[model samples]
Target: MPNLTEPKLISGNANRTLAKAVARRMSMHRGMSVGLVDARVERFNDQEIFVEVFENVRGEDMFIIQPTSNPANDNLMELLIISDALRRSSAARITAVIPYFGYARQDRRTKARTPITAKLVANMIAEAGIERILTMDLHAAQIQGFFDIPVDNLYASPIFSLDIMHNFRSQMDNLMIVSPDVGGVARARELAQRIGAPLAIVDKRREKPGEIAEMTVIGDVTGKTCIIVDDICDTAGTLCKAAEVLIGAGATEVHSYITHGVLSGPAVGRIQNSVMKSLVITDSIEATDAVKATSNIRIVPTAPMFAQAILNIWNGTSVSSLFDHETLTPIYEGMYSAA
Candidate 1:
């Protein structure tokens, strides 16, 4: 039997801010003494990750909110070690709430002599004693199959659609959702259909990673407000180039709403100099000062959304309602007050 009825959240160094936010959300509920598990994740002088669980977690459900974002290696290690400690301490179940799963891009090998790192990471997590996984907007949906445990991969469409409705309340008729590439059409199409907007595609050729050799627009974007939607934006090369293509095709302006902003290298500079009106990303990845300083880059808070999902999962309620735009208003709008 489980030690506790409610779940306890544990955070890692990868994104402590987000973990804190999740804790805060849980603290607001009534009859729910949900709070962070008393634990600490520190390091040795040799840069080794160490974790210690202070409080009794024996038979308690544990949720670790750690996104394997930048410095992914260290964060991944932290998660594995924390799970190991919890397992040893006799936690009932451990669910990894990794919003931005690192190495997800390496779900498969495009060339010979390359390893499928995503599969390997999944294996490592399973081996570390995690019972399940909860994540959002995985780069590839198929990555869920890599895990033998139950994986509840959430969608950001609910959050993204709400934001779009709020920001473009009046311009809904003129908006056109665009997939930066063919691979992202399904994601973009979901938003387009919800808001009753047209769909467009950016046909681009990638010779190698971080470089888009040639590009063209496949649908009519003329006189429309083009909004590019994608899962991951690492180098921002593809994002910036796709925005430029939309403008050349007579788009009124270009905007983007990517799930994970893994903005690396000159990504910030590229987005700033590009003709894009704005780039809206979720709080899945903590924004640095450069990202926060940009006038055109906006961050949508996912704390409320994630908090709701956590609540549902803990109660064994249906989280499927969170996948729809029409069904998830009160949660995102802060309807659940202090209880």
Candidate 2:
């Protein structure tokens, strides 16, 4: 068996907060050490990226933490160069731990001339010497099939599930899981099953890209508490529009549990003015100033779960239990009571 202990953690500039938390959690429990290589990512005259690994990483099992979020191309290029450097340094293995895998929304070709960028990203990582991948709640689970190496797709729901249990214990009876789109029905259904609630879907027509949505609800949500779940919340357009439809359908209160908050242009203002009671997102991507300032937005940390998974991987253990839906209940109870 491969030795899993004493793995060294290396990270890029993306989501440094999450990487540090994962590193700190694992090091404390496993007594392993982590070293960060200063890449100092900078742009060249032609807009290309330059990276230099500042530390020696020879003969180490390396995990490079980088989320391919905003400035996606640049951040991705940084990750590739860093991985190639470690590979050249004779690292035993290189694992790319991406809390948020960007380009995932482009997993399939929706129309003629459209490219599947998600597959391309996977190919790029594989070519960059990543022996394995560790990512969370990919926009499409099937995207893992695009990777030739082993991929461990982690879920934020376990983290979110705990939060829901503790924060809404008294209101569980009236809870209904709502999928903002028809495609996300499965994800919402999984969450609904975990929390013991019914599932609802929003039927919306897309008139044009970047335009307002025309929504029709699919389930009876009258006088009930609604929780909208999705993989990513970008621009907050879909979420805000869905909330309006749900409220109109008689939903008393609305909350959201989304994995990656890609809170791009106007997202903060939209959510602040929406009918949502609160919006909870994971720290997969570094929060923008607007995200932090928004009062109704609460952030839940995935550091513990991620830390535990890293430890287990290093120790040569099964990580499937980490995906168990029930594991989040007690963890949330603890956090809820403590908070």
Candidate 3:
């Protein structure tokens, strides 16, 4: 049996705001003292990384919250070094909490000589002595198979669904959920089912990386408010193109709810000039100044969900139950009292 004691939460340089938010939520929801593990992560003159855990973590379950987002290599190295530090400190268990898993899009080979970097990253984490992984919606779910340890892939659908209900309840009758491509139809369908809306798909062809060749609307979107759904909005090319097509096809308004907002390379600029009314994304990746400056971009908090999952894992409960929004009552009702 695993230890039922409260786990030590550690935050990395990547997405510290989110880590702090999760710590706060855990303290409130679990009715116990929860705080970030004191650690000093710094860089040497040659740009090498150094990590030192100030507190004694012997026999303690440690959860390190780090998302490999912008400056991906630095953040990833931070996570690995932190895990190794915790392992050497005699920690009972270490869970790498990577909210936005970078390199996940490279899970497979597109060319004969292309490498599957996702698997390589997974191996690195496992080799670094991480016993488990907790991440949000991965670009490719199969990436979980790349790891030998237990992996819990949480979804942002529940958060998006609740936000939609609160913001668009009055306009539900004219709403439609849209997938930017065929691959994302399943994700779009799930959100559509949750909000009781019709579904649509945008057939898009990519001729090269980060470029959309042609896009076409597959279903009737006439006079409907379209909600475009996708896992990541990297450059905003697909999103802008999809929104343009939906508007051209007679949709009244267009909005988006994406899991990770990897807004890179003129993405904010493109969104500013696009037809999208708003782009709702989770705080999986730390928001940049450009993201904050964009009026149409909104960030939804994901710490509550992550905090609940950490509590469940610590208590040896089912983390998957967090997916069912209807059963989330117990999460707020002191579910960890027995622990």
How far is 51's C-alpha from truth in model 3 (Å)?
Answer: 0.1
Mind giving the per-residue lDDT tens digits that candidate 2 earns over 92-199? 889888999999999999889999999999999999999989889999989999999999999887777777877988998999999998999998998898778999
Candidate 1 lDDT by residue in tens digits, 1-339: 422467789999888788888878777754455667778899899999989989998888889999999999999999999999999999888989998999999999888999999999999999999998989999998999999998888888777888887888778889999998899989999988887889999988988876778998998999999999999988898899889889999999899999998898999999999999999998899899899998999988787778778778877888777887556777665532222
lDDT of each: 0.87, 0.85, 0.91
In candidate 1, position 339 carries an lDDT of: 21
- Report the C-alpha lDDT of model 3 over 225-248, residue by residue, as the tens digit: 999999999999889989999999
Off by over 4 Å in 3: 1-4, 329-339
* Candidate 3, run of 10 with poorest lDDT: 330-339
What shift in Å separates residue 237 of candidate 3 from its native position after superposition?
Answer: 0.9
Q: Over 4 Å off in model 2, which ranges?
A: 1-5, 32-47, 325-334
CA error at residue 165 for candidate 3, angstroms: 0.9
| Winner on TM-score (1 vs 2) | 1
Q: How close is candidate 3 to the true structure, as a TM-score?
A: 0.96
